[model samples]
Target: MTLAALAEQVGVAVVNLSVMKNDRARAVRFSTLTALCDALDCTPGDLFSVVDP
Candidate 1:
């Protein structure tokens, strides 16, 4: 899904979504995480993967 579309659906900025995509997001509220998962038709694990940072 397009970041723009997701941002619009979640009422957030595209740049913020980009930050999350880049794994530079400092924090994410549970509500936002839930919304993201629902919008993307994915689980939280799909939105964020664990790896060496």
Candidate 2:
């Protein structure tokens, strides 16, 4: 799905979603993550990775 469509589904602005998509966001609210997970039919573990830095 397009980012615009996903944004609408997740009740977030396209620009904000774009920021998150581009890894520019320093943080994300749990509500927003839950919304995304619900919309995408996935879990947080599916969306994020803990990399060794």
Candidate 3:
């Protein structure tokens, strides 16, 4: 999915998405996660997955 498009749909700036993509974000709000899920037709699990370190 195009983050720019998703950002547009979710009323968030592309830079914010970029930061999230690069793992530079300190945190993400539940509401933002919900908006992303709703806009992308996906779940939080799809957006992020736990991996063994």
Candidate 4:
């Protein structure tokens, strides 16, 4: 699905979703994360990863 479509499904603006897509977001609310997971039918583990920095 397109970002715009996903944004609509998740009840967020396209620009906000774009920030998350680009890894520019500093934080994400649990509600928003849940919405994304529900829309994509995926787990949080599928969407994020941990890295040594």
Candidate 5:
């Protein structure tokens, strides 16, 4: 699915989803994360990784 479609499914703004997609997001809400996971049908572990900063 496209970013716009994912954003619509997750009930979040495209800009916000874009920020997460681009790794520019400083934070994410649990509810939003849940929505994303539900839409994508994946676990949180699948969506995130420990980045060596």
Candidate 6:
């Protein structure tokens, strides 16, 4: 889906979603994450992975 469509479906601003999509976001709210997961028909584990710092 397009970013605009995803943003609409996820109930988040396009700019915010763009930031996340581009890996430039510093953090993500749990509510936003859940909304995204629900909109995409996926799970948290599907969207994220451990990154060594």
> Candidate 6: how large is its RMSD?
0.9
lDDT score for candidate 5 against the true structure: 0.94
TM-score per prediction, in order, is 0.83, 0.91, 0.81, 0.95, 0.94, 0.88
| TM-score, model 5 to reference | 0.94
TM value for model 1 = 0.83
RMSD after CA superposition, every candidate: 1.2, 0.8, 1.5, 0.6, 0.6, 0.9
Writing each residue's lDDT as its tens digit, candidate 3 over 1-53 gives 79889899998999999998897887899989999999989899998866687
Clashing pairs in 1: none
Worst 10 residues of 6 by lDDT: 44-53
The alpha-carbon deviation from the true structure for residue 19 of candidate 3, after best TM-score superposition, in angstroms, is 0.7
Compose the digit string of candidate 5's lDDT tens values, residues 1-53.
99999999999999999999899999999999999999999999998899787
* Residue 8 displacement (Å), model 4: 0.3
Task: Show pairs that collide, candidate 5.
Answer: none
Over 4 Å off in model 2, which ranges? Answer: none
What is the lDDT, from 0 to 100, of the residue 26 in candidate 4? 89
Clash count (model 4, backbone only): 0
Q: Show the lowest summed lDDT stretch of 10 residues, model 3.
A: 44-53
* lDDT (Cα, tens digit) per residue for candidate 1, span 1-53: 69999998987899989998887899998988888888878899887777885
lDDT tens string, model 4, 1-53?
99999999999999999998998998989999999999999998888888898
> How close to the true structure is residue 51 of candidate 1, measured as C-alpha lDDT?
81
Model 5 per-residue lDDT at 34: 98
TM-score of 2: 0.91
Residue 29 of model 4, lDDT score: 93
